[model samples]
Target chain A: MNRIRKNPIFIIVSFFLLINVFFIITAGDSFFQLDNYFYVLKQTAMIIIVASAARFL
Target chain B: MTGNYDLSTGSVVSFAGCVYALMIKSGMALLPAGIVAVVVGILIGVINGTMVAKFNFPPFIATLCMMYISRGVALILANGATIRDNMPPEIGNLASRDFLGLPIFVVFIIIALLIFVFIEKKTLLGKYALAIGGNKNAAFFSGINTAAIIFAIYVIIGGLAGFAGVMSASRLSAGDPRGMVGFEFDVILAIILGGTSLSGGKGSVIGTFFGALVVACLGNGLDMLNILTFWQSILKGIIFVLAIVLNEKVMKNISKKTVAAARA
Candidate 1:
């Protein structure tokens, strides 16, 4: 378990799981709608994708 | 970055979009309008670089001034009105339409990042940026042209911001001077989350990339739950603070080692 936690993949998956759980509880059935997920992804596509360009020397 | 350099980046994006839209509206060819707008952004970068590097103005102060200037210019150019929906088919098409069965912007992001990764790992400029970030004084003592490097950094950031400005405007099919406000905050947060040190002496393009994705995911997930904007801000604030705390703690030893080496 500790080893898995050290892996970024595990951490990211768990984080998403936690978020998924929280949303499922709060928004209920609406949370399961695939389109909602797609909408959120589309909304921040640029914000998320382009930020990696920082050359912070 | 001690400099409010990122602040001006947001403005550059707005200004570039406005310039592009205005030129296109005035019947310029799409290619010329795009070129002119991006050149305008680069010119702002030159101003920022000169002020900070030559005049010895504090970077934050110089960039803060530039920020307001650019934003104001964008607003004035548009006369406080949004330029919406009348763009030539090519104007916003890069962001709005997909090509080859993939979103164009996504493909752009992939290619741009691949290029960045190559540069960061293989180029002299990238190494200089990392060295300078780690310790400006040390980098200078080691014969790196610190001012030139810093100037180049701002210019690169400026250019990226300019492209982003075009992308956002195109996606919305409008150039709103007020659009992209507070975008710097997101950039900074993304950087921090990627393990880039605020104290200087370290940089990670890959980390920044993943960090940005994580932040976007968090924000999107919250929106899914219909989280109020007020609560979202608070949550985001918490995450930002957490990332900072984690970064400071984890990098403390590394910074200490580098500082010791520099002193030696």
Candidate 2:
């Protein structure tokens, strides 16, 4: 548990979950749709690819 | 890698996309047009690299100047208009086509992620980048050819930005000079959210992937919730600040723990 607490990935994952929960509460079932998830994936693909360039930087 | 920031990536994306669209509209073959567009991006990178690595200009100032110059040139080339007519049908297909039920761009993302992860984990160049970023003078004394490495990093990033521009054009089915305006902010935000130190020396490609997903999710969720653009921007700002604070605190704790472990 302490090891997980110290991990940066843990923080990020927790933050991600927090945001999802917030959206779920506010937007309800629409936020849980599989199609919306895919839509998010497709929309973010380019940003993910470009953000990878910063990894080199 | 030397804690250098490239502010011109957004402009480079815009410039390269416009060039590709114009070439395709002018009847150039897709492959050739794409190559030229990427080359244009590389050329801009070379200029930026020279300014920073050769002339010793501050990275922020040099790239910021290049940003304006590239955007101006793109606007000129595009005649201040989006180029949509006479584009080849294949351009649209690039964005729409899927393989094995996955979007084509997602495949590209996966390929890019794998290649970059390999480079970061297994290559001498990766070591050199971290070394240079951690301490330039020490790396130089150790015979790292810091300038050359820096140049190469910038050039490679430029090429990637150019390719991204091509993808952007394909998605939009036109090259708008104004496309991707302020996009560098999103890229930087994603990188920071991924926990890549702005001060350099450490980063993770996988982390950046998730960071981008978070940003994308925020945008999509907000839009679905019928949030106004202004409110969405405000929310994103808050999240960005929170991410930075969280990252800093986490890093400090990790460093302190490492120090304690070392002493023990």
Candidate 3:
């Protein structure tokens, strides 16, 4: 627990999961589908690529 | 690494996209037009680097001026309209084509991720960036050629933004100066969420990957729920603030632990 708390990646992953859970509860099982996951990944790929510039900053 | 901000990134994307589209519309081949667009972006980067590094202008002010200039030029190029007429079939191929059951852009994302991760973790340039960002004066005094490094970083960033612009135009099958408005904010948000300090020095490409994923998931979920665009914007703003607060707290905790360990 303390170890996990210290990891920034863990915190962000937990936050991601929390948001997923919220959507699952509100939108039902449809929110957990693989197709939706793929769509999201596709949409955000450009952002991840562009944000790579921050690696230097 | 110079701890300099490039506020012109979004505008550069627009400008590059417009340039590419205009070239294509004028019967230029795909590869040549793409090259020109990227070169144009690099030119802007050179100007910015010169201003910030050689002239010692504040990064914010210099980039802000470039932002306005680039966006104005983009608007003028497009004549305040999207350029979609007579686009070649190949323009759609970039966005539509898939490899190994993945979109080409997703493949691009993977390649970019690997390349940047390598640069950040395994290269001398990475070390120099960290050194400069962590302490510019110390880096300069250590004979690191700080100006050159800063200039290189800006140029590379410009190239990336230009590529992103071409990708955007390809995806839309048109170039619109008005497109991608405020995109730089999204890029910055992903970096911040990935735990990159705005003050520079510490960050990781892998973390940025997850950060981008988190943002994508949030936007997708919101759209799935049929939320209004205005509401989505509000939620994104709230999340941005929350992420900042959480990141700050986490950084403080880590620092405190490190201090205690050192004392012990």
Candidate 4:
């Protein structure tokens, strides 16, 4: 488990999973909708992609 | 990532929302809607990056100038109208249309994401951009043409802003001189929220993705909860501040941990 935690892939995945759990718990019922999931994914995708471009520096 | 959504959602919202609001006000068409939004976004990005990296102008000052420039241009085009009717039909379709069970804006966001990721991962330019951010002096010393990299960054930003502008025009179906007021505010907020330091260097595309998501969720939640407009603004402001602080702390911790591990 510690070895997996050391991997960037695992770290990133775990971070995202924890974030999802937070949303599920705090966003009430809105977090459960299919549309909401898609919306969040789209939003997440945009920031990561764009910010990554800047990150190349 | 719902509860702890990326702050970039703020930018996406402002970009899309401004267009939608303006389109409803004037009735712009669809193609123009997408085009304008993209153009405007790229333009601002370019101007901000260029002035700071090349002229040594501070990012805050450079962007502050652009904020006014964008708004001023919009106001000039609109002839002083804030809201009006007779927007183009092409832009109107943007608000009304969806593709494959999703909003058109959603698709645009996806395309924007993929293109940027490709730029970051698959190009020499990408490495240069990161190099500049990570250590400008070192990059210059190592034979990287710092000015060129900055120029390319600005050009990309300008093109994106121009595209955003077209979208804005279409979304409103009319071009108002006053369109996209305080848009840079949202973009900055989103970028900051995604862990992009204002001081330059040390930011993550992945973090930014979450940042934008967080902003969008906040707005969506507020609207759903029927929160007042004023309260919404206040809430967003608070979130932006908190996100910046938290991002910095998290980055610090990550670095500290990495160092400790290395020593051990």
Return the top candidate by DockQ.
2
Off by over 4 Å in 1: A1-50, B1-5, B85-90, B256-264
Candidate maximizing TM-score: 2
Task: Please give, for residues B120-171, the per-residue lDDT of candidate 1 as tens digits.
Answer: 8899777887787766788889999888877877777777777777777777
Off by over 4 Å in 3: none
DockQ of candidate 4, scored on C-alphas against the true complex (2 decimals): 0.26
Identify the runs in model 2 with alpha carbons over 4 angstroms from their true place: none
How big is the positional error of residue B164 in model 3, measured in Å on the Cα after superposition?
0.4
lDDT of 2 at B140: 97
Model 1 TM-score is: 0.85
**lDDT tens string, model 4, B1-264?**
100111222233234435544644554454454555665566566566667667877555665576656555555544566434654354445544689988766777777767766766688776776676666789889999887777666555555455454444445555555444445455656666766655455555555565666566666666656678789899878977876676666556666787899999
After superposing candidate 4, which stretches have Cα over 4 Å from the reference?
A: A1-31, A36-57, B1-50, B174-176, B260-264
Tens digit of lDDT per residue, candidate 2, span B41-79? 899999999998999999899999999999999999989
- Weakest lDDT window of 10 consecutive positions for candidate 1 chain B: B1-10
lDDT of 3 by residue, B1-264 (tens): 346778888899888988988888888888898898889888988898888878888988998999999999999998888988887767665678789997788788889998998998899888899888778889889989888888888888888788888888887888889887777778878877887766667677887888888888888888889998899889889988987887777767776887899999
Task: State each model's TM-score restricted to chain B.
Answer: 0.92, 0.95, 0.94, 0.77
What are the iRMS values of all candidates?
Answer: 3.6, 1.6, 1.6, 7.7
Clash pairs detected, candidate 3: none
Question: For model 2, how does the per-residue alpha-carbon lDDT over A1-57 read when each residue is reduced to its tens digit?
Answer: 998876656666677788899999998999978878877877777677777866667
DockQ of 2: 0.67
